[model samples]
Target: MTQPPAAGPTPPPGAGWSGADEIHDGLPAAPAEPGAGGRGLRRGLLVAGATAGVLVLGGTGYAVATYVSGGGNQPEEVLPADTLAVVKLDLDPAAGQKMAVSSLLDRFPSLTSGEDDDDLRSTLVTPLLADNEWGLTYEQDVEPWLGNRMAVAAVPDPGSEAGVAGVVVLAVTDEAAMTERLEAVPADSFAFAVRDDFVLLGEDQALVDRLAAGGSTLAEDAGYTEDVDALDGDQVAVAWADLAGLQDVVPLAEAGAGLGDQALSGRVVLGVHAEDDALEVTGLTRGTAPTTSTAATEPTGLAADLPADTVAALSVSGLGEALTTSWATLQESGIPPEFEEQIEALGLDLPADLGAVLGTDLAVAVTGDLAAPQFGARVRTDDPQRATEVIDRVAGDAELPVAVSPLDDGYVLASDPALADALAADGGLGDTEAFRAAVADPDDAGAIGFVDLGELIDEVVAQGGDDAAQAQEYAALGALGFSASTTDDGGRFVLRVTTR
Candidate 1:
C-alpha cells in the first residue's frame, strides 16, 4: 500500500483525543482536510471502496470467523433479519486481495500491463497504506482476529446515504487495544460502536447503535434468509438482496428502464468463487410477484438437432407459456402501453395462437466460424400444419417474409430459409466434444446456451474498427455456458465461463 503522508506531531499520550472535538450528537460534520497523509489516506479509501464494489459485482466478516472455525455464532446472526442486503465473507481482506488479483491476472493478462505481483503491489497498494496506530491495529490485530466471519449489510434507514444505511460487522479481539486505536483515529466520517463479541461501524451512529442492540434484526427476515439459504456457502463470498425493498431506496430502480418495468418483486442471492484459472459468479433471482399460471414446458428433444460445431445456443421449453406470463407482467406494470397497441395493430390473438407463434419448445443457436456467423431458430408445436398457416398469416400482416419448415418434432424459423434447412441436417451440439467439455451434465437441464470465446474474439476483431479486439485476455477465455432447471417450487439458473 502507498505510504500515507506525514501526520504531523503526535498527540500527547493519554489525551483521550476523545475531547469535545471528537464527540458528536448525531451525524458528525465532515472533518477538516488533513495534510498530505490524510489526503492520500482518503484516496486510498476511495480506491478500496471501488475495489470492494468490484468484488461485490462478482459475489464476509467475524461472527463470520467464529462460524468459519465451527465454534462460534453463525455469521448471519451479526445482522438483524431486516437487512435489505448483506454480503458475507470467510476470507480476510489480504487473502481476498491476493485471490482477486490472481484470478484477474489469469482472466485478463493485459490488466497487469506486464507487472508482476510485487511490482503491482508497490505501485497500486502502497498508496493506500495508513501510518496510524489505528491502521496498524486493524491490519495486524482486528483483521486477523476477525478471521473469516466479517460481513457488511444494507439495512433500512431514513437518514443515511441513499436512504439506506450500511454497516460493517466483525468479531473483535483485544477490546482495549481496539478501542484505544479507534479513539485515536479521526472520527469525522464514520461512527463505530463495540458490542460484546463484535464491533459495528457505519456512517450513522444511531444506525450502528440499533444494529449493535439487535433492533429490527435481519436474522429474522424470512425473505432474506430464504435467499441467503439458496446461495452456495462454500465460495469466498455470498450476497443477498431484497430487490423490492431496494427499489424504494436506490435511484436506479425508480428511474425509467429499470427493474420496476420488469415487475421484479423478489430477492437475489449470489455466490462468487475463484476456480483454478477462472472466477465464477452465480446468482439466483426468485420473483415474488403473483404470476399468471402458464403451462409447464414439455420436453421436445430439439437439442439433439443443433449442429455439432454450434458455439452458442438458447433453449427454452414452453416458450408460449413464458411469453404469455411475461406479457401479462408487462401489462400490469403500466409502463408500456405501446406494446398492447402494437399487439392490437398486428391483429394477432396472442393467447389463441401463442403455441404457433413462439412454439411450445424453442431453441436458438449461433454456430460456425465467428468470421462467418450462422443463426437458427427451432420450435416445437402440437400441430405443425396449423403452425405453418399462422406463420404465413403473421408474415403477410406484418409485411415480414418469414418461412417456417418442418424439423424433427416441430418447425425451424430463420431469416434465411437455407439456414433453417441447414440446422435440421446436422447432428446436434449434445454429441459434440466442445459442448460436453463446456457444460456439466446437459442432458437434464431445462434450458442451456454456450458461446465459444475464441470465435467471438475473432469476430470482434474482424467487425470492430480500431483496437477493440487486441487484448491477450480474449485468448485466455475458452467458452461460456449457462443452464437452467425448474423445480417443484421455483427454478435455478447457473452461468459458467471457463479459461482456455
Candidate 2:
C-alpha cells in the first residue's frame, strides 16, 4: 500500500479527552438555541466534511491495493433515494481487478514507496485518529472496527432552507466498537446511528435518525440503477450526481447561462476501473440534450491516412455542418465581438463561408522529426476549387505560416510545402502498431485522438534535467488514445493509456 506522509503522532489513551470535554462544555445549553444552530452545526458539518474527504483519499489508496470483484454492501443500499450526490470507494474488488492493480504497482514501485505494511489501520485509521480534538486513538478506538467500504453522500434536508445535508457512511467490522466511539465524541452537533454493519454520521440528528430507519434507497432509484449499470467494468471508485435534485440547493443560473431546460434534469455517472496494462476512466451522461442531426458522426479514416510517423493526430467528421447549425446558439451564448471581427477580417461570411472552409471532414496531424516537427491539416470538400479560394483568403498576405495544396477531393494545408504534398499522397498511419494498440475502434468513433507519449518522453529525455530524470521513470508508459460517440440517451467517452 502507498504510505503517504505521516499526519502526526497519536495521542496517549484519554490524553486529549480533557480538551474535547472543555470544547463541548463551552457549547450553548439548548440544541435549539440560535448560537447552537449556527456555530455548533457549522462545526459538526466541518468535521463531517473533513472526515469524508480523508476517508475518500484513504479508501482510494486502499482500493488500489486490495480491490476484488463481487457484490457486497454498497452505500447506495442504505442512502435515501433523493441523494443529490455521492462518492463511493470499495476496498474489496474481484480477483482479476486485484491482479491488475497489483501488476500496475509492480510496474511503478514508486507508487508505494516508504510504506511499512499493507494494513488499512497504518495507512488510513492512524492519521485520522492522531491528535484529533475528538480524543480518538487508532489502536483503542478505530482500528478494532474499521471495515472495507465507505461512501459520502449529499441528501436533501427538508427542514433547512439550504436544502442539503452531508452524511458519511462507514462499514464497520464491529457495530459495538463503532457505537462506543460515536458515543464518546464530544460535540453537540455530531450525531450518529449504527444501521446494520454501517455507521451513519451527520450534523442533523433528525436526518440521521430518519436515514437509520431506511424507507426507500438510492440503489432502488430507476435512474441511479440504470446509470450505474451502464458502467463498462467492475469499478474501484464511483461518483454520481442527481442534477435535477440539486437545483433545490443551488440554482441552475449559478451554473451559467444558456443551459438547456433538460440539462439539469439528467444525472451524471463517472467510474474508475483498473486494467492489466492501464487504468481506464469511463463517463456516461443521461437525459441531457439530444444530439442534433447536424452533429458529427463516425470518422472516415482521414487521420488514419496520415504519415505512420505522426506524433499526434485528431480527426472528426461533419463539424462544418454542426458549426453552421449552432451559430445562432453560439452567438446567444456570448461569442465575443472580437472573434466575429477576426472572422470577417478573413474575408468570409459569418457561418456559411467559414463552414465551407472547414468542409465535411477535418483532420490534423504532427509528423517528421521532433526538433522541427511538421504540422498539417486536411479538409474534405466536394467543391475543391471553392475550398482552395477560402483557404487562400484566410491565409492572405502570408499572415499565417502555412502553404495549401489541392488534393483530388480536398485541400491539405501544412507548415512546409513538402508536408502539404506528402499529406496529399497515400499514407499508412492506421497500420502502425502503436496506433492500432492505442485506438480501439478509430473508424467507428465520432471523434478520435492519439498522442505518442513515448516520442514526447524521448524529447524530454534529450532535453536532460530534473524533468528528464522524471520522464525516464515513465519509459514503460506508451501512447494515449481518446474516443467519443453520441449514444441514444447521451454520450459515452473512454480514455486509455497503454503501457509496455
What's the lDDT for all of these models? 0.56, 0.69
Error (Å) of candidate 1 at residue 73 is 9.1
State the lDDT of candidate 2 residue by residue for 1-500, as single tens digits: 11112124533334444432342322112223333232233234323422332232233543457534555688888899889999987777666667776776565554455444365534655554445666556655666677777898999897977778899988877765455455656547478776666778888777887887879999899989899889987887789898777875767666564356544667788887777776666777678733333327555568788877888888878878888888998888787889778776776676877677677888899886545678998889766777788778877744888899887788899999888887887678889877787776677777778777667667666867655665565555667776767777887666666666
**TM values, all candidates:** 0.62, 0.78
Model 1's C-alpha root-mean-square deviation from the true structure amounts to 10.6
lDDT of 1 by residue, 1-500 (tens): 11112234533434323442343222212335744532233234223322332233222111112121234544567677767788876543334444543554445544434323222212222233334323432233233334345677887898755788878876664455445455545666567776556677777767776666655456667776676577553455678777677777775446764445455467777776555444455666666532222324344355656876666787767777677667667556674679768767766676656656677777887666534556778777776766667777777877875567875567777666767776767566777655655564466566776766545555445655432344223555555666666544355556555655
Error (Å) of candidate 1 at residue 301 is: 4.3
| Number of the predicted model whose TM-score against the real structure is largest | 2
| Index of the highest-lDDT prediction | 2
Q: Candidate 1, TM-score vs. the true structure?
A: 0.62
* Model 2 steric clash pairs: 67-93, 68-92, 68-93, 68-94, 69-93, 69-94
RMSD of each: 10.6, 10.9
